[model samples]
Target: MDAFANRPLSPDLPERHSVHDMLVGAGLRPTRQRLALGELLFRGADRHVTAERLFDEAVAAHLSVSLATVYNTLHQFTDAGLLREIAVDGARVYFDTNVKDHHHFLVEDDGELHDIPGSNVTVANLPTPPKGLRIDRVDVVVRLRREEG
Candidate 1:
């Protein structure tokens, strides 16, 4: 089913006043599930969210969005610079609301993400890219495991 079909291009927005307006600013067409998910996502301080975790939250809010929809929307949002994607591990990925340059800490036990300021690390000794390409950005993830009981 088309999750965005017939959904409002404008809904009750979060603090920014209009989630639809925000989506439009981000170049996304405001669909129902997208608006709902946007409200859930952009309503507070910047943070990270995984598709599975967002799916759980959507379900709890009685939204009818499927996990696939969440994944697709997240990718779309990332492509539009509404969020940033980080591959924490081979099997784990996260979307960060703060799109600026920065690093992260991955909590192993709970799979949570914590921001590490951009100034905390420096990259050096990078090989040159091909003639047609230039470096866009770099990502670093620090993993943490809890102390055993």
Candidate 2:
């Protein structure tokens, strides 16, 4: 099934909270670049975006933000649990603002990301940790390819 086919195409979603609020909620200082970048990342509908894609979008929108700023903001967001980093491939990293426990399906042909609800997957018993090390998170990325007809 085409994951995006069933998705809604509406444009009137509610605006997200102010950047200052987001920064305060995440326990980070609301710097100028952080404010702008936070608005860009979280103001709209939730999305799975790469840093390169975000840079391009910022430039196209005339937002004069620097690449370093984007990287730094992304790092901060990830550290604060406001964003979830997904390693679809070894090199390319995608950032998702939805921090809920869920999985993703990546279409290899076009780099499309589809969110998989957590309720659909079941987890059984697992092995215990060896020692002081603890389990931080579990992320699942299923890469999809078109099957020959």
Candidate 3:
């Protein structure tokens, strides 16, 4: 893990309070686990993380949080629009903090994610929705594999 990944919590900006504020802003009640895990998710730079990776980081940080709590918190964050869930593969889900309209490039071997700026792609035409249903949004994910030399 990198240094920032393992850095200690800032006393002035504790995870508990940060998570509480985030939840409150998103109209969610700040539960104990939610607060703890949300700090882990939202603090520092934006990332593409999995539940397992989050669990490991929490444990390393001595948060005493459980794996289930990580998943639950992630789901809540997604619901609250604080985190964006990307379906990169059948068995794995990646969370991103860049919630704006954009796309992703998934590195298959390492599971790394890269943001694809929206301006780089153009969608000039699209099929209209039928009936009363409306299009909420569109997501494009480009899966990439390392080319052998």
Candidate 4:
């Protein structure tokens, strides 16, 4: 159990103070744009989102944000360890709110992403890295689709 373990995964957004504190803790200056975007990203439950999807969400929420700004902000958050970047395909990328090490399951039909517990997958028999390079982490995305009947 940890400090964040108590926060419930709900539909409601977290208090602004907490989001502000999170940005500060991440060594980020909580600017107006960041605060608004952070509120949407950090609102309730660990989930995955693409930059375009997030931009649409911001627009739907009546927040005056640009798509480019959304992409830049997401990259910043990932760099600050506030989120994780998952590249499923060269064309599709997802920013995960849960920064913990874990795998994912992608539903092909619905294009939904679900988290797989870190312990659920086993990775073994890895080739040694090059002389100076080291393996930081391995991300596995299991894609699934319903069988044709």
Task: List per-candidate RMSD values in Å.
Answer: 6.6, 6.4, 6.3, 2.5
Question: lDDT at 90 for candidate 3?
Answer: 87
Ranking, lDDT, top scorer first: 4, 1, 3, 2
* Global CA lDDT computed for model 3: 0.77
lDDT by residue (15-124, candidate 1, tens digit) is 44466776787668899988999888876567799999999999999999999999999999888887899997789889997787799988889999999999998999
Number of the predicted model whose lDDT against the real structure is largest: 4
Q: Looking at model 4, report the run of 10 residues with the lowest lDDT sum.
A: 1-10
* Span of 10 residues, lowest total lDDT, candidate 2: 1-10
Clash pairs (backbone) in predicted model 4 = none
lDDT of 3 by residue, 1-149 (tens): 12122323433335566657657777788887777777777676667899999999899889988889898888888887878898876898988866777888888899899999877777767789999999887778888999999
Candidate 1 to truth, TM: 0.86
Q: TM-scores of all models?
A: 0.86, 0.82, 0.82, 0.90
Runs off by more than 4 Å, candidate 1: 1-16
User: What is the C-alpha lDDT profile of model 4 across 1-149, one tens digit per residue?
Assistant: 12234334535557787777777877789998899998998887788999999999999999999999999999999888888899988999999998777999999897889999989999999899999999988999999997999
Please report the TM-score between candidate 3 and the true structure.
0.82
The lDDT for every candidate, in the order shown, is 0.82, 0.75, 0.77, 0.86
User: Which candidate number maximizes TM-score?
Assistant: 4
Error of 4 at 63 (Å): 0.8
**Residue pairs whose backbone atoms clash in candidate 1:** none
